[model samples]
Target: MIYLAARAITTVFLLVGAAMADRTGEGGATIGSLSMRWDGQWYWVVATAGYPADLPLDATGHVTQNAWAFMPLYPVVARALSFLLGGQYPIAAIVVSLIAGYVACLALYHLLHARIDRVAALWAVALFAAGPLAALFQMGYAESLFLMWLFLALLALVRRRFGWLYLLIPLMGFTRPGVLAFALLLALYGIVRWRHRASDPLPARQIVHIVALGLLAVVVGFSWQWIAGIVTGDAGAYMKTELSWRRSWIGDDGGFVPFDGFVQASAIWFRVWGLPEPLGYVALALLVVAGAALLLFEPHVRRLGVEVRLWCASYALYLLLVFFPQSSIFRLLLPLAPLYGALALPRHPAWRWSMLGVGLALQWWWIDQMLVLGTTFTQIP
Candidate 1:
């Protein structure tokens, strides 16, 4: 009942937010138009126009953004659904996202309920709904689709259905490249369990089956890169295209920095707080380390089960590694919904209610900044 009520209320919030966002400077306002922004536009292009035979490049020989960077599954699904909606790809994509988002919510609720108390489970659902990028769940984006497969992967782990993981790997991979992080976490867990000879009811033959399935998961999770290589005839086609956007971000000193988001945040601290840059960076890094330690050592997180804890920990690291802080990180970090188990921890009633209030305000702030304040799609997440 809590899940159903939360789902209905979230749906209402999203539709109302979409309508408000739609009423921009332009006279025409539609849900599809509001939904199909930023990455949604690229997915829509792929669904309607398909990938380019040749990688598009600029005069400087840098790869220009193109459809090759996006995974194929969402667009493929959107294309098929378009037929039902008179070939309106944008509308079709929004429909797919809304349905997927609700289903993902259900999966999350079930997974939480099985592990945590009903109150915590309900709070986790509510936390996921009130998150800053919760609005993205309503948009024509793959976040919710990827999340559906992700929570299913969690459910599979809880059930100890190791073989089901193999299927979810590719399904999740084609939905979002972040599945690689998930595959790695699973493989690591399997390896540790095998080494410890953990209490398992499975026979030796089933152990072998589990190992083989893990290998397949890792391979299939990386299949998108191989497919891009085949299509563009460049071994690094996907990474190159995906990283092309970083050219603008990397500044004059060109190279990837691990935990670049932290570095960026440090810079923000220096500018905003007038702290010494070195001091600011160290302070930010320490804060991050402290937060990570709390999550890892917290009794609440440990109680969420080993698999869920490991998955959340691995994904948080993945975000630190690849996701430079931007408006997009709001959506990127939505995959960390499992960690909302923290919200389930016993806290003062005022503290819990205050956190939810803050989250909802931030959600509105993000939506308004992106939809109403920003002039271009590039400015929005």
Candidate 2:
């Protein structure tokens, strides 16, 4: 009920934003079009036209952005639903996202309920449903779907149900690009279980399952690259396609380097704004330390249990290793939605209401900036 009401409120915000954009001649008059903006359009292209056999290149023969950057599952599901909706991909995509968002909420609630009081768990769901990125629930993006799978996978891991992950991991891998974090989570989880074997029995069967699931995650994580390579006849097609976007932001710095994107991005962003590059490095180091301390020492976060903290650490490490901090960084952090439980630990009505108000305010600000007034390159959402 909270989730549905939150979506209803978000719908009102989107409608108002669309109207405002239309008034400004920014071209977001209709809800359908608003939902299909930004990367939503890319997903539509992937669904309708399919991936290119040959990589599209610019005048200098550098690979430009194309369908290869997007995963196939969400668009494919949307395409199938479009057929039942008389070929309306926008409506179909939104429906898929909405349903997935609802399921994600339920999965999140259960995931939290296992570790916290019922009221805190419910409050976490409310906050998540009305988060700054709540617009994602109704948009034509795959985040909600990926999040649904991710939450359920985490639930399975929490319950020590290894069988369900065989199916969920592949779904998560195809739904989005972050399943490598899940692979890392499995490794960290195994270590924790092994260390506590005296209290928590890590039987031989469970160890085999853990090893197998970890191997499965790694395979599925890189499976898209292999598939793209086979189809495009370029072994580096997927990586190159991903790098194209990063290059657009920070220029072609030769080849892809793990863990270098943030270092480069911090310097570039600070230099662009006329700040000292060393300050950016200092700020980045502080951010990393703060994040680590939050997971390791914060009381509310500690109450969320070891598994949740491990997942947070795993995903953070994965992002540090591969992701380039940019406008999309907030969206990428959606996978850490489980952490909302920590935020919801405050039982005071004042804090809860204040946070909700702030979340809605930020949601409106984000929608206005990214959807209404997004005419330039820097406004990419």
266-332, model 2: which lDDT tens digit per residue? 9989998999999999989999999999999999999998889999999999999988888778889
Quantify all predictions' global Cα lDDT against the true fold: 0.74, 0.92
How many pairs in model 2 have backbone atoms within 3 A of each other, for residues 3 or more apart or on separate chains, i.e. clashes?
A: 0
TM-score of 2: 0.98
Q: State in Å the error of residue 50, model 1.
A: 1.2
Off by over 4 Å in 2: none
Highest lDDT scorer: 2
TM-scores of all candidate predictions against the true structure:
0.87, 0.98
Looking at model 1, residue 146 earns an lDDT score of 94
lDDT of 2 at 69: 92
Residue 171's lDDT within candidate 2 is: 100
Query: Which pairs clash inside model 1?
Result: none
